[model samples]
Target: MTTAAMRVPVTRGYRFEWVKLVSQWRIRLVVLACWVAPALFVAGVSQQATLPVDTLFGRWMHATAWAGPLVLLGFAGQWALPLLTSLVAGDVFAAEDRLGTWRHLLVAVRSPRRIFVAKALASLTVILLMVTGLFVSSTAGGLLAVGDRPLVGLDGHLLATGDAAGRVALAWLCALAPTLALAGIGLLGSVALGRSPMGLLLPAVFALAIELAQMLPLPVAVRLALPGYNWNGLFTSPMQLRSVLISVVAGLIWALTATALAYLIFVRRDFTNLNHDGSARRAVLAGALPLIALGAATVVVLAVAGLGAGSGIGQDKVQRSLATAFAHLYRVQTGQLNRPDVTEAQLGASAACTRGGGQTDPEGPGNDWRCVVSWRLPDTTAVGSAIYQLDITPDGRFVADGDGPKEVNGYFLVRTPAGDAPNPLWQFDGTVELLPKG
Candidate 1:
């Protein structure tokens, strides 16, 4: 008797794997966790807005309007994503050994390549679902709690409401790129370290280690290669396209290399000896330690460089400029010069004249004159204080003294004929430059 020809199409393998994966309860649990966690976090933030305290936290929360959603993505990528991917990817080959079904499957399906492709596709689908769920949940929560108001950036600049929302969306999308790299690494780990906790925990640990290393003050070249840099654009006001592009390229390299290595090892290794073997433990640690060390060293070098840079002169200049500019602008906007009171004695013994409000000037064009201004709060609970000085230049221009921390020095263009209807002498116009020490 001749047996009927038996032919199982290659496409059937993927369908079979997907059907098996969807039937598993583990995937459902992970999907639920990804969706629920961010929803609850958003609810908690909304409740916190009603508390009676300083608005510092409130302001910070408003600024980071997209943080909750992004953080949910980060958290899942760190642990949950890896663990879930491993459920299918890790067990792809090993489960056959555990169930003593590998030989049977080998005989029945007659193709290991088809089985591998099917399982990989199934894992990829789950990751896509989780990422989508995180983005939707986060956007909903942020809008509900924060309102669609304009965003105030960390630098104190304002962003229009529409621009802020668009940037936020871009930021979320940028964050996902690194997450995909992480998922690829997890897939590699699951396949290589089959049926062991190392398959699950090692990738998560590696991701955290990379993050810590990037925090160090390393060379710009090395930092560009690390995955952590991929998210830096998210924090920048107008996203730095160059930096983001470099990070994306580096992530792609790492993902491809890792996946290739995992596939090479899994396809060649014998799975029949699957048992509690110390050899597998050694292999896992031996492979992971060097990468961890490299990441750690990068962090240390970068951190030291950052500390050596001191308090950052550019930042200091920006802050002082902003403070001075805002003060003057507010005065201009309000149309009032509310000078505080200073005593004649506080102006120094060389004072030529003293006004009731503590304003003072020295006798000659070359003298250094100092004045102190003080005012009591209406409630009498606190007192406001300031000091101003005048330095007479050889050019006959009365330069307002700003050499000391208490003084703001600048050239004052006084009116030649003193007080008039629109007192020209009383009008002060020129740049108010802060001294280096101040």
Candidate 2:
């Protein structure tokens, strides 16, 4: 073939790959599973009020039409997203090898690059269909089970049904980036490991492993680099724009890096020696893969430690954050926007926090620090105090858990009011930002 002729657009190759993909019974079955499974889950979950509360949007299933999908999105971030995206992407390249059509397809195409692009595109198309299928099915199940109702947001604010639906829809759209990035990772696995099973299994294993690593005592920055760390940002009260952006950027970096590595491997691979089955069998390099993984892991650990070092908020910063968060929480709890006596300057909400016990180490388990916050309420009848058990992120963000005897049930930060009318001055249930002092 002439150079110009060989350089023809890969539209035909793409069409060919897509056609073959659609014709496969396996593809149809996988797509069916993706669609039906989420629907089934939502149907069962919507009938009950006791859904997993550890996740966002799980507290109230019967309360809203959008709860089911939002809850499922949280579970998806754990494993479902990785598995579903990888299911098709992992099969893209390996399917050709498994069916022993690599050489024929390569020969039929004008260039290997065209064939690669076509396969990647097909895989991405499949991932998109799966996401759409799940989203639609979950939404349908939610609406069918429960008629449209106002949703109680994370900040204890009630959102109208239409507004809640819009936010849920936006969240699903945001999820697209992470899923596509996982598809790219799976494609890398498919290319590296010619066996279909390896392609299917490795990406999921890697995703789960990374999740487990995030849960480890590693630095918070390291966990933030993982895929699902900020997934809950989608369900935040105002929707955490910064967190969403960070997660998307991390996903893009992983996807592009994996794709580039896979492409480099594909270009340099020797395809001359094919097994009797017509699949090109590349020799696996001994120890190289493990060594590379170890090195990468070490680099990540060091980077996390470096970033985490001295990143915690000091006493003054913590006090300011506590005061601000307490004021806001008090407003939400009391259903009063503002109280004249609760002013920061006059009230003097002071928090004495100490690190140790539950917070022995910076990255240890359980909430590390406990703060005794004393403040005068709007009535100013007497000084009131409450205990705040907090877990601080490496970047100085504090999340207070008020699950102790002094507070209400579930996780929240509690403050006892000076008067007996409203027992707790502030009952906040979210992360409190501690900004740097200028």
Candidate 3:
């Protein structure tokens, strides 16, 4: 071979990959799907006057243009994001192997490293462009279909339009990291399996598996370990900076690990590994089953560990616990966390807990217990009492609801903190002060 033909510059490899990628119909289909899907989703949603309360920003989408991008993102992350990324990334090495073109590439390219890097660049470029297309199309369609009003936050507070838009943009930027992680997964599957279909299928299945694991009643730490675990932090009230940062770091780690592992395997494996009847392909495919089994085993271990330990309780202790919980809850709502009136016994607090008809197992699963609590209102001479419904979990966390305090309505209650506690003393899910309606 001529020296001029043998020396393939770095840029030439990348440019060649780009040309091959654009020449395929998959890239075009992905781009068209990205723009068209968002438009259709917005159109269908606009037809219904009702907001999608199930999804993040579904309610906000009816009024705020900023919500459009967020809503689109929320839905896309579920499945579309994985599939779109895999469509391009998954095909990188697998398609070439399927068509028996890797040998030709090996002869044409100076090094396998160049080919791998070029394929990765092409895949990353595809994902970025597709995501940008979706974001822009969704945002434009949302503004035209919905009004550009202020968005209602997760806390039911209104956020400024400019601020909400800025946040939406920032959220999209943060989302790119997770997209890269999914692409990495796709690339790994492509290189390992050397089949186009498996490349596309594995990443989506991997995403679905991680998502399902996250939804299980696992410990916070275990859940956080899953992919895309903290991606929703962007849509959370006040924007969960800590979770977002965690997601960014976790995503980068996942992407780097998967990509590095794929590169290592690809570099060592013989070119014949890409063949259908090769021993390498048979060994790799057979090895997949054990890896899958190991993954399943890991999930089972996590689930069991996450469950922790909880003991059964009798009704008497349940009543006593409710009474104590109510007293602390009242003190918390009244802003007397440090006072002697309740905790120090300078004054008295009382509660009567029951489960109707003199039931024995008030704290039993699926049973709703009732409690009538009495405590003096803050800075008031008279005492206030109200009936409340308590739902106690197996783990002892309970939610108390009633006509509520004279000044404010609380949704839940938490255990009292010890001296110099690190976290907040109160852990109410939400609260609304009483307001007189005309």
Candidate 3 lDDT over residue span 307-381, tens digit each:
212223345555544444455444443342343444514225566777754565453433366767666644569
lDDT of each: 0.48, 0.62, 0.62
The TM-score obtained by model 2 is 0.74
**Candidate 2 lDDT by residue in tens digits, 340-418:** 4244555566777667853453233335677677767665589767677777654333456553344422332324354
Please tell me which predicted candidate would have the highest TM-score against the true structure.
2
Report the C-alpha lDDT of model 1 over 67-91, residue by residue, as the tens digit. 4554455455455554554554545
Who is ahead in lDDT, 2 or 3?
2
RMSD in order of candidates: 15.2, 6.0, 11.0
What is the Å distance of residue 51 in model 1 from its true position? 9.7
Q: Which candidate leads the pack in lDDT?
A: 2
> Can you give the lDDT of residue 392 in candidate 3?
52
lDDT (C-alpha) at residue 409 in model 2: 21
Q: What TM-score should be assigned to candidate 3?
A: 0.66
Q: Candidate 1 has what TM-score?
A: 0.59
lDDT of model 2 at position 379: 51
